[model samples]
Target: MRNVLITGGAGFIGSNLALKLVESGSNVTVLDNLSPQIHGDNPELSPLYRSILGKVKFIKGTVESRQDWNDALVGIDTVVHLAAETGTGQSMYQIKKYSDVNIGGSAILLDLMANEPHNISKMVIASSRSIYGEGKYLCKQHGIVYPNARSAEDMKLADFNVKCPVCSVSVELLATDEESKIHPSSIYGVTKQVQEQMFMITGQSLGIPTVSLRFQNVYGAGQSLSNPYTGILSIFSTRIKNGNDINIFEDGLESRDFIYIDDVVESIMLSIFKDEANYQIFNVGSGVCTDVLTVAETLKNVYQSNSSVSISGNYRVGDIRHNFADLTLIRSKVGFEPKIDFLNGIKKFTTWVNKQEIQKDLYEASIQEMKSKGLYK
Candidate 1:
């Protein structure tokens, strides 16, 4: 069995990946600082923690520290780097904190790996669709945008200009390929782009097999039900459970390509074990874009609740009007395809949410606290 190290192994995506690896009989080690917002004092992930508590080694430490990296990398053959400060709007206010963790901390990890005794076989990074910024989509070889709402006849291979209805600003509707331009609107996106560059450059120079998976909106079990700073699904689920209004920042027209946690874990495993994934970048998404309104509607329908959804005119800075992934390369390279559809995924998530007997008021308070701290502004 290959020895694998998963950073941020207590967080939603990381923990899910770790569970899969451990179940497959791989020797897995989880390095997590257990940030309060992500994993601290919460019972949502307790089942995961309990399952692997004795089976896998767990280290509580920040990725920004050199000693943490050294200790985590001792017997690891593959590294799945998933740790990051992911609050997009909050990153605008706390620029230094996001940079220090997402960019600076990632660089340190790469540096530590470069000095390891046995040559590390591979390194996989969890990247974001936010790196494409506001207006773009992922393009297919035929140059068709996969998730475009425009009819087949309306989509033209020739360059086309698209405008955000809210901003009225004209933008090119080009789908970002692996070679697309790196334009980040938020500090979170900027830092993620930097992290991807650092891995690519370090891997090239050090002869380490590195791959980056640009993940779309990932949501599933083990997600912190208490954190309001991120995880829109979790936030909405909590609010609905409390009989409170589901707040939409804008007109609820903003769209995203949501990928399930299981699909994400599979993609990471493919990159770790497959020789074809070396030194490459792939998009992990469902190749379909669903808007916020649709998601909210789906949740409400699933819960069989009449919880009112309030579409507040208030908008967050650095909010993208639309973003989705182009999945052609990832499908061809890693043979990865999202198994769960959005409707089914939502059903599964709702079932899980209903089973949890957590306090609803606490989640609402957390949302208010985030707003008060200017983290969600």
Candidate 2:
């Protein structure tokens, strides 16, 4: 049996992975701080944490602690680093918090790898599509070009589409490939970029195989419903749970590639065992773009709630217009393909959400917090 260490193993993606690892007979160890935002004040209050209680070893602490890393690394042969602050809007104002957790936490791992000796054979890091800021677009005059972030002035006029860099004409956002540009629009994105770079660079020099997964909008069961800072679906569902209206931002047409959690876990397992995936960065997405309007409508119908959908002519800073992953590279290299489509995945997610105790919706408060910081407009 292999020894696997999953940092942030209590969160949605990480917890699901931990379950998979435990069932497969791998000796599993979870290292997480159980941030109050995600797990509430008492971590044991979370069903996800309770599920893995008897199956795997658990450690509660921040990754920034060298002592915690030293402890979590004990007898661990494979590592999957998923610990971080994930709020895109909050990352803008809490610059030091995001940097300290994401970048600084990653530095601790690299430092330990450089100094300490262990049996670590491979590592898998959780990266994000955020690094591909305003990713690829087809410009009539410029062929394929990566545009800059959408302007606030354009949003005020309700012109929410991404424009061509050269001709300034509206452009179609295309599926981003692994070789696409690495320009991240948010501070969170920048930190993620640095996080992956440190792992790959340090892992290589230390003779450890590494895989950086650029995951796109992962959602499914066990997603935190109360955390308004992340998981749009969870936020929307919680609002609907409280009989609140659904607020659609940016004309309700901004699109993203949302992959189901099972598919993401499948891709991670593939990277863990495949020799060909070493020293590679792969994009894990459904390879299909689903617009925000479609998602809002779908969730409303599934929940059968009376909440009306509002296409608010509002926008937030550091948000991307549209992005989807070109999963060709990962498919070719690791033979990974998404089995759960958006509609089927939504049904499963809604089924799970219905069983849980309805959380008090904090959608407005989250917006107000961002608005106070000038992040929301």
Candidate 3:
């Protein structure tokens, strides 16, 4: 059995992945700080933490500490590094915190592997689609182009679509391939980009096979319902449950490639098993773009909630208009195909949410924070 260590293993994705690894006969070790944002004030009371209570070796630690890394690396054959601050808007304000944890923590891991002695053979780090800020697009005149960040001037006028860099006309959304430009609009994206690149480069130099999976908007059961800084699905669910209206951002047309949690876990597992996944970056997403309005309406329908859908024409700085994955690379490399479509995925997600207690709606406070920072319009 492979002795695997998963950093941030108490998180939504990490916990789910840990359970699957344990079920597959792998001895799992989890190192997580249990941030109060994701896991309420008392992490021990979190269902996510409790799910893996006695199943895997759990360590309460942060990735920022060198001692913590050393403690978690003992006897580990494979490492899955998933610890990072994930709030895009919040990262703009908390730049130091994101950089310290995401980039600094990753640097520590790679430095230790370069200098220290260990039995780790393979490593997997979670990269983000955010790395491809305003990713690939098809311009009628320019063929394939990568648009620059949408201007706030245009966004204030309610023009949210990404325009062609060459022609300045609106462009068509293309399936962002693995080779797309690596420009990140937010500090969170920048940190993730640096983190993945460090792991890939360091892992290759050390002859330790590393895989970077650029996951797109992962959501489903076990996701933090109280975390208002990220995960619009969870935020919307909480608001709907509380009888509050669903506030849609950017004309409610801004789209994303939402991949289910199970699909994400399956993709990671495939990368672990397949030798071809080494030293490569793959986009893990549903490959279908679903707009914000559709998501809000779907949740309202699924939960049969009385919450109205409100389009406030508000746009956050560093937010993308629309971008989805190509999926050809991941599919060809590790034979990964997403099983759950949005319709079915929503049903499954809502079913799980129905069983849980309604979390406090912290969405307005998060917006106010961003607004005060001048990131929100």
Q: Rate the local accuracy (lDDT) of all candidates.
A: 0.77, 0.92, 0.94
After superposing candidate 1, which stretches have Cα over 4 Å from the reference?
40-45, 116-118, 135-175, 359-377
Name the candidate that leads on lDDT. Answer: 3
State how far residue 227 of model 3 sits from its true place (Å). 0.4
Candidate 3 lDDT score at position 254: 92
Per-residue lDDT value at 199 in model 1: 94
Give the Å error, residue 352, model 2. 0.7
TM-score, model 3 to reference: 0.99
- lDDT per residue for candidate 2 within 277-312, as digits (tens), equals 999999999989988889989999999989999998
* Clash pairs (backbone) in predicted model 2: none
Give me the displacement of residue 355 in model 1, in angstroms: 0.9
Task: Kindly provide the TM-score of model 2 when superposed on the true structure, using C-alpha atoms.
Answer: 0.99
Clashing pairs in 1: 137-175
284-372, model 3: which lDDT tens digit per residue? 99999999999999999888988899999998898999889999998988899999999999989999999999899899899899999
Local lDDT at 148 for model 1? 23
